[model samples]
Target: MTDKLNFYFETAKSAKIGIWEINLESSQVFWNAVTRDIHEVPHYFIPSLEKGFSFYLEGENRTRIKRLTEKTISNGIPFNDKFQIITAKGNVKHVENIGQIVYKNEKPYKLIGTLQDITKEQNLIIELQLSVEKFSSIFSSANDAIFIIDTSNGLITDCNPRSSELTGYDNNELIGLHNSKLFPVELRTELRLFLKYNLNRNEYTLNETCIKTKSKDIIPVEIASGKKFEVDNITYLVCYIRDISERKNVEAKLNLLSLAASETTDTIVIANEKGEAVWANQAYLDLTGLNMEEVIGHKPGYLSKGPETDLNASLLMSKAIKNKESINITILNYSKNGEKYWFEVNITTVFDSKNNFVNFVGVGRNVTQRIEKEFALKSLLDVTNSQNNKLFNFTHIVSHNIRSHSSNLSMVVDVIENTDDINEKLSYFDLFKEGTEKLSESIEYLNEIITIQQKTNIEKTKIHLKSEIEKTRMALSLSIKESNILITDTIPDNLIVTVIPAYLDSILLNLFTNAIKYKSPERNATLEIGYEIIDNYTVINFRDNGIGLDLKKNKHKLFGMYKTFHGNEDAKGIGLFITKNQLEAMNGKIEVESEVGYGSNFKIYLNEK
Candidate 1:
């Protein structure tokens, strides 16, 4: 019996099992070498029953151990359980406890128990349980369908909840189903062959194919071959299937839009948010006479703007883009071949579903022909209106001037016929001669006016404006000297005008003569000539300090035929009228600002672009 007890003690010690005993009457604890090592205590350490219980973890562990110990001591009952305890080194360890009461003379005398450290085993078990729970949670909530297939027969061993939702099949129906059944008939054989290939390889393989649902609907899907794994000595493969039906639908729509944009006649250009051109359709390339290489990475219409393009329209488009707004503008654009065309472009801001600014889409329509026709119509209307005004002026001349001449002649002839003296009759002949001369002069003026109106198609030439003004001033040198007038020419040396040469000369002479003729007697006369560039026009301003007219009272008739001001006998009023017509014939216009007794300024606008 002593040898057997020693053998058992050696076996328990080798197995790292501990033995402990508590004397009930003495309240003392005895710990074997293995039990002392389990608590990380020295072999010489002595312990009491209370001190032994103190090593248990607080709360539930200590309370349960106390309860089990009291019951065993009172009824001599055996106890077996697991508990946690804090070792002497402050390490928490899991332990198994088995205790029984040793009876002496039918009364409980001592409590004996075995203690074994199970920390590593308990941690491994807990890790496995957590891993299984995590896998279950992910499988249930995944977006893509996951299938576990048995590599031997290509049969689906298991599927996730998403698999059931994707295939319209319950978990029971999906289990044990052949993996090929998930694909349509047309792709089933292909899937089988692909799976067979995947079994031999550990890497993933992806294929785009169609799958069949329970209702026979075919759905586009992308199947990714996952890594092969083994369970219970059987090899299995995981397949991740993702539905691509929406993606395929979006691709189809994009292709359709691309085709339409490429084939349409209207120019279409798509620009990035930075206002740089990213893409342009075939029509845009053709319209601009540019290749894609020249267009990409440049702003839309940047290479197409010419001197004739409306700056206002260009600015408006830029402003709209900066503000991320939409705008429509018709602007002149030039092609690569230097040909000009009008383009009506509608640019819209594009945004994503999140309302973020994406880009700009510009649709440009060629409106050159329509714009040209409109300009021609406007020119024709201007000509018609001008001719009608001339007709009205002629009617006034015939009714007012010619009728007065004829009446004078008739009255003089009547008086001469009623006269008895020969000298009186001879005097009437003098009056008759004067009347005929005046009528002939009036007819000559009418002919000159008609000729000016008829010369609208005369070719225009570019002439230095200052040089022309100097020449006109020299021609009127004597008049300027006689009137004591001062002339200041502030027009730039490079200032030039496009007009009929003869018309410009005539206009300059008239302006100089008028300034000299209308000099203010109160002060020495002064004239200031300057030029300004406004938009597409060059405005030549002739400002004079002279005896100005009451423009408020006579502004309406200022340029009318035979309308005279200042009561000067030689005013004729025809000079200004003829000057206006000459300017109009050359596609120019004149405006005047004058105040009574102060001065007059005339601004002539010329097409100098």
Candidate 2:
């Protein structure tokens, strides 16, 4: 028996377990070497039941383990328990005690069991339990509503505390409810569609949808869902939902602001620092005659540059972009069809939240009409200045000419008065009379110039260029035939010019008379009349194959009053000056391109009206 007991003890030690036997009547307990080792004690350590009980915490666990051991030994009942044990060295161990009651002559005597050291296993179990508890706490306290719905039935089976709070429902009220009850009527259809599409594929999705609270109030929610399977062969859809009412409100307000920006009437373009367009509003599309696809990602100059655009516009833009400064400028731009327009653009830099330069926003207005008005005003000022200078020169010429003629007349009258011979007196009187008549004619001519200067209400009418040329030709028929000059009209038959009738006639008459008067003695005076329409102006070119002036020396005085270059017997020098003044008064201009001994080409620019 001793050898058998040693073998059993060796087997238990080899198994790394402990075996214990308790005699309930004597209250004694026997522990094997392994059992003592499990308690962190010496092999010789011994313990009693009462002492072992003391090792257990003072709680129902201790009482239950003691009662189970006592009852098993006294009543022949089997008992199994996991409890704490203490050894002679006062070391405690976690042990799983499984025992059976032993009987002698049909009466319970002792309890026999195996004590397995389970401290490591118990510690792992405790750690797992703690983790579960912490997870449960977080799940209950989370802000988002969490639900576990049975996929097979589409019924809500479990929900966290937050779910109840968010849905305005108690746990009992929500656990057995259908998921449809939590969704608004409109969203229920969407939910059905989503399930049909995703359920078969086991796909997950996050969606913004509306939910119905217990109070029947609709709440916006963002829902994230995933599929989960349980050990019991049950499938569940785990859904996390969050209230997004505030987010939705902010989004709505942002959408409204975007809509307002897009619909604005001013051309609005946003460009990145690289000078690439990032965003453009509807007004920009309308103003530039380009679609969003065509303009976005392109530079602003893409829509505003053409052959006639000023190079300085791009220079200013480059400087402003490099310095990140706001700039305002007026630029001549082209539309999609290459039609020229004027834009007044204001560009400003936009910064990010970190105050870093991010983009530039340009607001442009179509100032084509306004710019044209400004040009018109400037042109009028130029005309006014020219007219003023001409008037001053005309006044000076009138003073000089009238004084010369008056002095001549005065001298002649004095001679006639002092002379005794009737014949000499008569000749002096005749000469005086001629001088006075010449002065009178000069005064009349000055009055006509004054009238032309003061007259601002000249009726504008469209006159056919060919017919007007023909009329001037007919009116100067006597001079044309006398000068032996050849006149050719190369003007288009349908070409018409907007001008005052009298001014057009006078202009044509002056040009023709000059061509005849300055005819080259060595060459036939061939005159050519033609016109071309450019933008909003009609350019009439009158080229004369005549004895052109020395432009290098006389270009400045070519249109000056009383400045005669040819010194002809009938060179009054007033014709070209008055023609220039009249052309300017009518918002037109005359420019001459000439080569000495070659020919003169007079270009008259008249408003197209």
Candidate 3:
């Protein structure tokens, strides 16, 4: 009996199984060597029933083992169950336990159980479950229609839900269906050839084709086949089919738009968000006289360069592009050959479906003729208004001055006729002669004004502006010195102005004399001359430190023939009147900024082209 017991113990130890026994009456516990090793306890370690139960983990493990032992003790019912335990080294291990009760005198006497570690087997089962769940999730929720095809016969063995929805067929109808039946009758042969060619290849193959639905409607689709795989002994292919009807529609629309852009007469250009040209229509190319090679990677605004281009307009365009804004502007741009043309363009920013700025679209056309006509009409209107003002002035002078002269002459004749004295009559002759001379001077001034008005169409020559100002200053040197006035000329020496020679000289002389004549009595007088280009016109500014006029009270009469502001004894007022007319004849204009006690600034605008 002892030899058989020893043999069973050795076998259990070798098999890595453990045994435990509890004495009911004495409440003692015993562990075999294998059980001691499983709990990581020393061979000589003492054991008790409570200590044996403590080795089981807390919560479920502890409660379950206690219940099993109690049941075996009360009813002698045997148990085979799994549990977890913490070893002496603080390691967790899964174990299978088997328990049976020993009876004595019709009552339980002892409990015995067998345990085996099963951590490795439990881990493998969990891993397999997770992998199956992951594959099932992906296969069920894939976006594209997926099919598993038996490559040997090109028959559909399995398919995802999307496949049924794409083909308007049920799962039962799709399974075992021939792959060629999915395509239109006309395209089935080609699709079969393509599949056969790529059957054994180790790479995915892609093609665009049409699929016929069960309802007999043909839908465009992009078909892609993943590398062939095998399950068991049968080879299978994963065929992915995606509907491409929307993409094809978009392509067709883009092609039509491209045709319109290429053939239209208006200029159209597409540029990247950085303002560099990416594409241009034929009209844009023709307008700029540039080929695609020259335009690409360059800003379309490069065409807005030349002597005549407006810098402000160019700056506005650049600012608009930087801010991703839309703008409409008419600007003068020069072609490759230096030919200037007025271009009216509307530039708009392009955005993607995500509302991200991507590019700019500029559509423009040549507006040179319309702009030139507008300028001509404006010039004609200015001339008409000037002529009307002069006519009004002439009528007022005639009505007031002719009647005064006639009344004075009549008075002189009455005195001579009523005097009846030779000396008296002779004295009246001197009065008559003085009146006639004043009348003749008035008539001469009017004639000069009429002559200035008629010289509107006279030819203009380009003259050095600073040189002319210097000459006029030299001519008025004596008066300048007498009035103690300082003159400052800041105009560029190379600055040239197109004007009638006599008119420019006359204008400069009037401006200089007026400054000297109006010198302030309280302080040293000074005049500064400067020039700037604005709105396609050259503006000459004459700023003076002098007693300024109250323009609010005298603005209307300031340029009238007989008007005067200051109480100067020699204030004739004819200088400014004639100066304004002269400027008008040359299609130029003058504006004055003046305050009562401060100073005056006179700006003369001349057409630059």
Of candidates 3 and 1, the better by TM-score: 1
Model 1 alpha-carbon drift over 4 Å, by segment: 1-23, 28-63, 71-124, 141-143, 161-170, 184-186, 213-217, 270-279, 287-323, 331-342, 350-360, 372-400, 403-433, 461-560, 563-571, 588-609
TM-score per prediction, in order, is: 0.70, 0.53, 0.65
lDDT of model 2 at position 285:
81
After superposition, candidate 3 runs with Cα above 4 Å error: 1-121, 261-391, 406-441, 461-580, 583-609
- Candidate order, TM-score descending: 1, 3, 2
The 10-residue segment with the lowest total lDDT in model 2 = 84-93
Most TM-score-accurate candidate: 1
387-473: candidate 1 lDDT, tens digit per residue: 998889788887899899889989998999898999889978989999998888878888888899988888888988888988888
> Cα miss at 389, model 2 (Å)?
2.5
The residue pairs in collision within model 1 are none
Indicate which candidate wins on lDDT. Answer: 1
Whichever of 1 and 2 has more lDDT, that candidate is 1
What is the C-alpha lDDT profile of model 3 across 1-609, one tens digit per residue?
A: 999989988999899899888888888888898888888899999988778889899999999999988888888899999888899999888888898988899777888878788878877877899999987887788888999999989899999899999999998999999999999989998998778767867579999999999999999999998888889999998899999999999999999999999999999989988899999999998988989998989999585599988999999999999999999999999999889999999999989999999899999999999999999999789878868877887888878877787788888888998987898899899999988877777778778888998877899899999899989988888898888899998899899998888988888888888888887888899999999999968999999988997999988878888787887877766778888888877878889999977789999888766
- Cα lDDT, model 2, residue 83: 79
